[model samples]
Target: MLQHSAILGGGMGGMLAAFALAPHAEAVTVVEQDAFAGEPVPRRGAPQARHTHALVSGGARAMEALVPGVLAELAAAGAQHINLPGRYLGLASRGWFPRYAGRQFILGCSRELLESTLRGRLRELPNVTVLGRTEVVGLQGSPAGITGVRTGSAPLTAELVVDATGRRSRAPRWLTELGFPPVRESIVDPGIFYATRVFRAPVDAGPEFPAVTLQSSPRREPGVRRNGTLLPIEDGLWMITLSGGPGSRPGTDAEGFRAFAALLPHPVLAELIEAATPVGTPFGFRADANRRRHFERLRPCPNGFVALGDAYATFNPVYGHGMSAAALSALALRTEFERRRKPGTLRLQRAVAGAAANAWDMATGQDARYPGTAGPGPGRFDGIIDRLGDWISASSGRSRLVTDIRADIFALTAPPSRMRSPRVLWQAVRGGDNGPALPDPPFTAAERRVLGVRPR
Candidate 1:
C-alpha cells in the first residue's frame, strides 16, 4: 500500500489527482512549475487559459464527487450552466439541431477561474500541499519501480508518483533514462487553428441567453472548412472562438478574426458581436493535435508510477473533452485505489488509460477525416466507424432521438456503445420526422431580446 504520493503539475488534472489520492495516502504533494497562490490570472504554464473552456456534465459530476459542492461553488462564482439541446443554438454538420428541453448541460467559464477554484478547494485538505514554483527533473528509481522524483539536486521520495504534466511531459525521456523501452505514441494533427477574443455581452444578456455555434462539415469539399462558437462566461462577457482546419486557418489579427467569423455558415456570431466591446486583442493557438502515449501497452510496466491527463493523452480542445477526461481518469484512480486491497500500479494505470480511451477515439476519430490531417490515418475498421459516425451526425440534425443520444455521448454521460444500441440504430435507419432544417439559428425571441439582437 502507498503511504506517500507526489503528483506533477498543478492544473485541473493534477489537483484532481491529489484529491483522489488524499484519502489513501498519508501525504499528497503536488509539484507545480508555476506560482498559482494568487488570484485567477493566466499563468505562463497555461497559455491556453486565455481561451474559452467548458466543463461537460460528466466532468462536472466527477468534480462534484471529488470535492462535493464544486458545481454550486462554480455557479456562485458566475459560471453559467447551459442545458444541452435545450439552451444551445447549434449548427451541426448536416443542419441546425433543434432545441429541446434536455437533461445534460455544461459549465462555461474562463480556464483560469476553473483552475483557481479547484486549487483553492484542494488547499483545504489537511494532508495535501501544492508546491508551486517547483519542477520535477527526473525519476529516482529504475524501470522496475520508481521510488521517488528529483527536483534539481534535491529529491523527494514517494511510494507512488503520478505524471499530470500536460502534453509537454518528459515522462518518455525519464523512462528511457531509467532503462525502459520507449512508449509508443500516436499523433493525429488536423492543422486546426483557433482565434479567440472576449467581448462584453449586451446589457440584457444573462444566464438565460442561449449559446450559439456554427460547425464545419468534414464531408464538404472544395472549400476551406471553419467553425465558430459564442459562449457566455462570467460577468456578462461572451468568449467567442473561431476555428479553421488546414487551408482555412483563422488569423490572430482583429480584422482577420472578424472576417473569419463573418465567413461562418451563419452571420449570427459576427452580427451579435459587431457592436460589442472587445476585451483585448484576439489571440491565436495552433497546438491542437490529438496525441496519445500508450503506457498501458508497455511490457513489465513500472510499479509505483503512472501517467494521467495530457501526459497520457491529449485531445483536440475544440471538442472540449480534455478537462473532463482528466477528471474521469482521476475518478478511476480513486475507485481502483479504494476497491483493491493492494492496488498494483500497473492495474491502476490501465484503469486510468481506460478512462481516456473513449475520449481519444471520439476526438481523433473525427480529426483524422479532415483534409490535410497528418499521421497514420484510420484503419479499415476505423474507417467503417467513421462512416457510421458521419451518418449519425447527419441524422442527428433531423432526428431528436439521434440528437439526444449524441448529446449524451458527447457529454460523456453515456458510453459510445449507446449509439450502437438497437433502438438508436433503428431510429437512425428509420429516421424521424425532423421537418425542414431551420434556415437560421433557432434562437428564441426571449434569448434574442436578451442579447439585444434581432432574429435573422
Candidate 2:
C-alpha cells in the first residue's frame, strides 16, 4: 500500500524530510506558512537565518546524497568553502587553536542562499509538493497514533505526518488536542543575543584568509561575556556578528555593534568592520536557549508519524551546529525509510532519535558549562570532561593532536568519544611536545592592514 506523508514546515528540516520520505512515501507534501518564491527571500518562519550558519561536512554529505548536485549548485551560487583549523581560526577558553591539516570542510553562505537552493532543488522532485502560505493548526489522530494534519479550513489526510515546524512547533499542543500529554522538553537559555552585519569582502585572499572566530570564555571573564565571528560568504561579502550571553548582550545599533566586537577577546572583528564598506543595516536575533523535545521516550508514537530537525531538537545557534544536526537527523530518517518500508515502526523512531541523541548530548552537555545555562548542570563526570576539553583546546596551540580532535568534534563528523580515545587522552593528560604557540588568531598581513591592526 502506498503511504502519504505530510511534512509541517518548509525550511531545511521540512525540505529534508520530504527528500528523505519522497522515495518511500507515495506522496510527499510540505506545508509551509511563509511565502516561498523558489528564490531565497527572507521569510518569517526562520528569523535566525540572518545570522552566520555553517553547513558542516557531516551535514553537507547528507545533503549532497539527498539532493544530487546540491553542493555544486551552492558553490556555483557563491558559497564559501572553509576547512577546519586550516581555514578556520578559533579561540577557546584557553587560548588560540592551532591550524592543522583538515580532512573535512564547512560551507559558509547566507541562510537565504542555503534555503533557496534547497527549496528550488526539492521542487524538482516529482513526489514532493510544497504548500506555501499554509499553517498546520493541529493534528488529526488519537493519543496512540497520528493519522494526518489539520490546516486552516482543510483536513489533509496522510498515512504519516512529520513535524519539522522548527522551534515554534505545535506538535505537543496538537498531540494534547488529540488526548495525548505534553512531550517532555528541556531548555537551557544562556540568554544569547546576536547582531550581524554584512559588508563587502575586505580583500580576495582566496582560501588563505580563514574564517575568524573569537569564542566566549565562560570561566575566564566571569562577569564580562562577549564574542564575535567574521565569516566570508559568497560574492565579496563578509557576515560579521557580535554575540553576547547571559548578562552581556550585543547592541542593535551599528556603532555599538562595532564597539561590542572591539571588546571581544580580540579586536579583529571591530577592525575588519571599520575598514570594510557596510552593505546594509545590521540584523539581530535573540532566543531563550537550547531546547529539545523528547518525542522518542513517549509511550506511544503513531506508526505513520515522525519528527525531524528543529521540531525534534534545537541547539544554541552560537555553536553553529543546528544545520549539521538537522542534516544528520534527516539521514537517520532516510536510512530508516530505506530499510523499513512501513511507517510508525518503533525501531525506526528509536534509531532516528538515538542518532540525534549524540548531537543533542554533545551540544547541551558542553553548553551546560555556562553559569545559568538552562538544562541539567554538569555533574562531576561532565565537569571533568569539560575541563579536559578546555585544556586540550587551550593547549592545542601547541599540539597538532589536540587541534585535529577539536576540529573533528566541531564539524559533527566525529563523536564526542574521539576526544577520550586512549591516544588523545594520554597526550592530553601529559601535554605533548610544545610547538610555535599562536598567541591569537593569525590575520593575513593584508587583512591586518585593512583592519588597521599592525601586522604581527
Candidate 3:
C-alpha cells in the first residue's frame, strides 16, 4: 500500500480520485484552491456546475461499485434515475428515436448535487483528508517522478500525486519545469456555446418520467447547429439545455431562451418550455475545446504522478460525458492498484486513459463534424466510418437490435467492435429498407397530455 498520496483540486474529479485511492493508500489528501460551504450550492471554483450533467450508466455503475449505495443515496436526495430510450425521447437529424427497452440509463441532476454528494462521501473515508482554500503552487519532485505538491506554506510530499484539477490544469508546464519534454496537446474545438435554465416542472405535466431531446445535425449546412434538450431532474424540475457553435449563443433571458428553443428542428422542446414556469435565471456556456493530453504516450510515465479527469482530457460539456469518464477513470485506477501492490505509473496511466477512450472518441467525433470546428477534421478513413455511423443513427430509432447495440456503445459499456458484429452489419446493409423512422416522439397519451403537443 502507498504510504501517502496527494490529489490536487477538490473538484468532482479530485474527490473521485480520493475515493479511488483511499483504499489503496494509507492516507490520501485532496487540495482545493477555493472555499465552499457544505451545502449543494454553486462554488466559485466550479462555475460550470450550474449547467446540466448526465451521469451515464457505465459511470453510474462504477460509482455504485466504488461507494456501494451511493446511487440510492442520490435518488433519495431527488436525483432522477432515467432509463435510456425508454424514459426519454431522442431526435437526431434523421428523426425521432422510438422508445425501446434498454439496460442503459442516465441520472439527471444538477452538477452541484452530484459534486456535493461526492464531497460528503469523501468525509466518510477515514483515510482521506481535504485541504480546502489551499492553492497548489507546483510539483515537489522532478520529471523522474512526482513526490508530491507545493502549496502556499509547506510543501506536501507523498509517494504518489494525482492532478485532477479540471481544464485549467497547469500540469503540462509543471512537468516541463521538472525536466520532462513539453507535453503535446490534441484539440478539437466545435466552437460551441450553450445555455441552461431550470424550471419548476409543472406537476400537472403528467407522471414524472421520460425526458425530451431535439438535436441538429453536424452534417447540416456548415455553420451553427442548434440543438435543445429538456430533462426532468430532481425536485420536480426540468433542466433545459440549448446549444450550438460558430455563431451567437442562446441568450439567458426568459423570452430569449424560449425563442432559441423554438428555433430547434422541432417545436417539442419549445412547447414544453412554454408550458412550464421558469425557476431561475438561465445560465450559459461550455466553450472549452475537446482537449486531451496524450500522457499515456509519454514513454515511461512519471512514477509517482498521473492526471485524471479534465486534467487528462476535457470533452465538450454538450456530450455530458465528462463526469462519467472521470468516475470510470477512478475505477480504472483502483483496478490497477488491486492487480499489483507496487504497480508502475506508466501502465497505470494507460489504464486510467483507457477509461476515457469511448467518451473522447464520441465527443471529438461529433465536434469535428460541426462547421468551423478547430483542430483536426475527420480523416479520409473516417468518411467510411461516418457513413456507417449515419446508417446506425438512422436505423437506431427503428431497429431494437440496432438501437440496443448503439446504446451499449454510446453508454461506454461496450466496445466499438460491437458495431461490426454480423447482426449490426446486416442491419446496416438493410438500411432504411426497414421503413420510416418515428415521425413523432413516441409519448403515451398521459405524456402527450402533459406536454400539450399534438402528434406531428
User: All candidates' TM-scores?
Assistant: 0.95, 0.94, 0.95
Separately for all candidates shown, the number of backbone clashes (residues 3 or more apart, or on different chains) is 0, 3, 1
lDDT of 2 by residue, 1-456 (tens): 246889899989888878888888779899999886777788889988888887878888888888889999999998988888778888766667666667778898999999999988888889888899998898897876788888975889988788899988888777877887678888877677889988776554443467888877766676465778888898868888888876677777888787788789877677777767788889888864678787877666655667778888888777787777777777787887776666445665676677566677776776677775666677768777777776765444467776777677777878887887887867766666566467767666664556563222
**Highest lDDT: which candidate?**
1
lDDT of 3 by residue, 396-423 (tens): 4477777777677767897666776888
Candidate 1, residues 124-191, lDDT tens digits: the string is 99999888898899988986788999985468899988999998999889988999999999999888
Worst 10 residues of 2 by lDDT: 447-456
- Candidate 1 lowest-lDDT run of ten: 447-456
In the predicted model 1, the residue pairs found to clash are: none
Better of 1 and 3 by lDDT: 1
Query: What is the C-alpha local distance difference test score of each model?
Result: 0.83, 0.78, 0.82
Clashing pairs in 3: 87-210
Candidate 2 residue spans exceeding 4 A from truth: 204-208, 394-396, 433-436, 453-456
Give the Å error, residue 153, model 3.
2.6
Runs in model 3 deviating more than 4 A are 220-222, 395-397, 431-435, 452-456
